[model samples]
Target: MTVKEIREKSNAELLNDIETLKAELFNLRFQQATGQLTNPARMREIKKSIARIKTVMTERELSNQD
Candidate 1:
């Protein structure tokens, strides 16, 4: 998802998305370890998405604290 899309979600939704992504990441790692992964690049995408979500979350938190 793009930053705009990510930013549109509520905090609860963002947290849920993060949990889902983390689960997917774990499964992808397992596939990689067993030589079953078809798309290794997905791992990179997922990591970046997680980072983006966290960045947005932090931004919101800081804004709220002000």
Candidate 2:
């Protein structure tokens, strides 16, 4: 997901997206292990996306805590 797309999502939606992306990343890892992955670079993209979601989630949480 692009940062712009992510910025548009509400926190609940972002959480849902994170869950979905993690599942997909898990599947991709399995595919990579089995040499069935069509695009190995996808793992990197997914990983980065996950990080972005988590970062935003944390930022929001921290702000709320203040």
Candidate 3:
């Protein structure tokens, strides 16, 4: 997800997305372990997306503390 898209979502939605992405990441890792992964690049994409979401979440938290 793009930063703009992530920023547009509510905190609840972002949290849900994070949980879902984490589950997918776990599944992808399992597939890799079994040599069944068709797209290893997806793992990287998911990680980056998770980072982007967390960054936005932190930004919001810090702004709120001001």
Candidate 1, number of clashes: 0
Ranking by TM-score: 3, 1, 2
For candidate 1, what is the TM-score?
Answer: 0.99
Residue by residue across 1-66, what tens digits does model 2's lDDT show? 887788788999998998999999999999989989999898999999999988888887899999
Per-model TM-score on C-alpha atoms? 0.99, 0.88, 0.99
lDDT (Cα) of model 1? 0.98
Better of 2 and 3 by TM-score: 3
1-66 per-residue lDDT for model 1 (tens digits): 899999999999999999999999999999999999999999999999999999999999999999
Clashing pairs in 2: none
1 versus 2: better TM-score goes to: 1
**lDDT (tens digit, per residue) of candidate 3 on 1-66:** 999999999999999999999999999999999999999999999999999999999999999999
Each model's Cα RMSD: 0.3, 1.1, 0.3
List where candidate 3 sits over 4 angstroms from the true fold. none
